[model samples]
Target: MTDNSVVYDDNIMITMRGVSDSVGLPYTVNPLELVDREALVELREGPAGSAGPDGDPAWPWQWRGDVADFSALRALNLTTADARAAWRVATENKIYYWTGLEFIAFDQAFGRTGKPGPANVLSGTAVTGVSGSAASARITGTSPGQNLELTLPRGVSGDVGDPGGPGRIQDAADVLIDDDHSLAQDYILAWDATRGKFVPAPSPRRGGPWAIAKNQFSGGTNLNEPKVLAAITIPGQPTRWRPQVTGQVRVNAANGNGYGTRCDVEVRIGGPTGELVGYGFGYDIQNWDWVLIGPRFDFPPTPTTDFGVVQPNQTITLYVIAKRVKGSASFTVDTTGAQLIVYAEPIR
Candidate 1:
């Protein structure tokens, strides 16, 4: 009919004569199917007052005038019985209303009689809001035309919302990828099949876990062959890596009196060696003693240029090679001098 939107038939309710979009010649209307919820709600909010036969709870009665008391009202000399029946509110919050020359009883609740709050001061003083340079803010207005302005400093912030309970997100993936697989940072967060969660993974674009070799290397291999100075195991086989190596190589003389003339070092990923890093040959390698490959780690040693692609299950290794010149040709490397800290930034 004209009342309700057409919906599926729950059952054949009490039918009436009406044409529907579905039915052609035959007219049928269900009482439940034609229920007008909006019309019902409108009827519920229709004009209501205490004067009506239906006694509405809240009645908007206007206080036409006010008098001091019932004694003062009697002193008005209304002159006739009908004139005495007019409505008048007293200072004691009592009402004087009448119907058909019959006086009505008093009810304090019919009008506002108490303070607005637990301790609200009922004053007619107007308030104004103005911005200030104070460190903290104070409100002048809460709602528009409320005459109160929420005065705040220049950088202060304010938000108006109903107070509610806190909400939460359980998964980090919800924040990073908004619960979508397309936006997941595969290199930074890897899927751990065992735990079934995203775990921090090694990526060539970010810093990986440190692979340190703190064990002392006593009387390292001869300067002729590359000595395995420090070896570190880098987990997660990232595609590419730029390893940062920190440590010093001491080329010890074979006879304790003989030192190497020069020293060199390189990094090897898996099995293959990458580029070699070297410092200039100083006096320690030739006349006086064994060569020290680097300055103290406090000073920046040669940065590793090795961007080797790591294979699966392969560990990153650091190798050192030293060249001999004057004193003794057989100078060996001693790694016990400094602590080696190595880490590889992967590019997966």
Candidate 2:
């Protein structure tokens, strides 16, 4: 068999054929396809005017080009005579070759009218394909590969919000430290569990002179004990010393002897250089003639003679030393003590 290829509408087709040599044996030959010159030219021009067989006009005697108006075409009064006349004149004199019978039928099937079909009438067909029928399904039984799966194009995914700027940890730490204070307003130092050292707490809520009203005291017990509950460093202006005293130390005698025991309160004000700024001693003991007896609170008989003062460069410390002695038939001595209530500004 010989393979022959031909062009059909706007494409090519291949067919097998067998030819015999002089020996009458069949041999295969591949022949080049030939173009139908007449058909090609006629199809290019589309339908032509035709005359009727009986010398009358054909039903659609005059054919229009692609741009002709369809509505106007229907109004044309073409008849059989027009078609016959056109066919006889053209065929006999060979003025133009005739389109095959099938081609003629194709042109007049709608009787001198044409209209736009579908936008996709040529859908699924590849132009310039092997055959006029268009590139059809694979005929050689070639298997199709796996189906292609489409996905979002690169960088075309969902919108992602921009990342927030990193937090400023160092700045935040500085802010926290700024708000913290070294010691309490009236508290000099406090126990810190984490650092295992005395941490300065903020100043106490109270301030100024902290007083003590003594009520009772045993022989040598509890008198020398300080009533100054707390001392704190002042913030902002840091030049003055501040200490606070609280609670009371009662001075009542424990023994009921001839005369109760006597105790005196003294305040000493000085500086680290031993410069005395003020001094005060209150005579709380009685019986000064024989060896003071009885429990008493003597203010030096006058404020001018007993008041304690603190100079700008001095600090104050107070001591309350109480001693009692008996010179009668029995020998007895009692000692009790009390501390002073010292008030001052904060010293940093």
Candidate 3:
């Protein structure tokens, strides 16, 4: 009898062939079972020794092979489709795949169902209780089979809105500041947020306060105060001033001897005695005529508060002096005790 109890490739029935014909044995058949004594011996002791690897040392079934041709032994397909499907399901359920393969969550394969629907279905996350420029947050959930959403809150601020278009310049006065008749042409102004006020126009370049008058001969605008050129007083240095004119200085009689004489000042910054640094000049009024003032010589020590990071002790002093040609009259040339105010402000 052929070994009918053995499991072979499911398609190959080991006993389908006549055992007697195949094994050169006389086959005997009974109603209950077919038996061939010689064939049974052959099956038990053939080149393919036994049914299982554990039972037989020379078993043909002891080794594994490509299952593609196993159809001859089995009726069912043995594809790993089920395992792959389970992995995808695990990715969808976020039970295993998310914790394992992070890329799976971002990929369309994991969450994509072959369907025509909205990409995402989350409602607006409204921030209910917000006070100032501090803290604010909201929560929202998406629709079924929708992509994840990430929302963040912004903190409070001291100001509001997109900050409307810059303020309009009403007139020439808004554009000008501390302007004397002597032409100070170029100037700029802007709104100061910290100080909550409008700052006067700044100089286009490093120089005197930019001023200009239409007519120089007639002297139309009578500028009362002395226009400050540049002033730096390092405590240890000499304070000097220079007159605008180099040669003979004269006061127009309309300036009333010295009353109408206005002296221009040139300030030279340097070390004490006569070490040159930087220089600037502006008109200082005597009576009213524009008279030359000094690009002076003066040296003053650097103060701790003024120059940051720059070592104050290492810095040399600034020297300042006032030099002006004598007036046709005594007082016209005299600027001994003239008042000067220099205001320096920073622009961001």
Tell me, by TM-score, which candidate is best.
1
Q: What lDDT tens digits, residue by residue, belong to model 1 across residues 1-348?
A: 485765554543443343234323332322334463321111112224467485667534444477777778666555434433545556666677644344565766455566554443332333334446544333343333233233444543578879867664334543333335333244456566776765555453544545443364434554555455555555654455455555555555455544444444444444325443323243543343333343222234333432344444465555443445454445566555444455554543
Superposed by TM-score, candidate 2 places the C-alpha of residue 44 at a distance from the truth, in angstroms, of: 26
Best by lDDT: 1
Q: Model 1 lDDT vs. the true structure?
A: 0.47
**For candidate 2, which ten residues in a row score worst on lDDT?**
94-103
Residue 156's lDDT within candidate 1 is 39
Q: Candidate 2: RMSD over Cα atoms?
A: 29.9
lDDT pick, better of 1 and 2:
1
Better of 1 and 2 by TM-score: 1
User: What TM-score do all the candidates reach, one by one?
Assistant: 0.34, 0.19, 0.18
Q: What is residue 315's positional error in candidate 1, in angstroms?
A: 5.2
Error in Å for residue 325 of model 1:
7.6
lDDT of 3 by residue, 1-348 (tens): 787776444443224322334465554552233343212222222244447545555312221222332222233332433222212222233311222222222235345566776665544444424344444444445454333333444455556668667665534443423343122244446565665545554443332232222221112123343232223442211112121212112222224434423343343334333433333332334343433432332444232223211121232223233333333322323332333322222222
* Runs with alpha carbons beyond 4 Å of true place in candidate 1: 1-161, 169-218, 221-224, 237-240, 255-260, 275-306, 309-315, 320-328, 346-348
Q: What is the clash count of model 2?
A: 51
Candidate 2 regions with alpha-carbon error over 4 angstroms: 1-206, 216-286, 289-341
- Worst lDDT run of 10 residues, candidate 3, spans 236-245
The better candidate by TM-score, 2 or 3, is 2
lDDT computed for candidate 3: 0.33
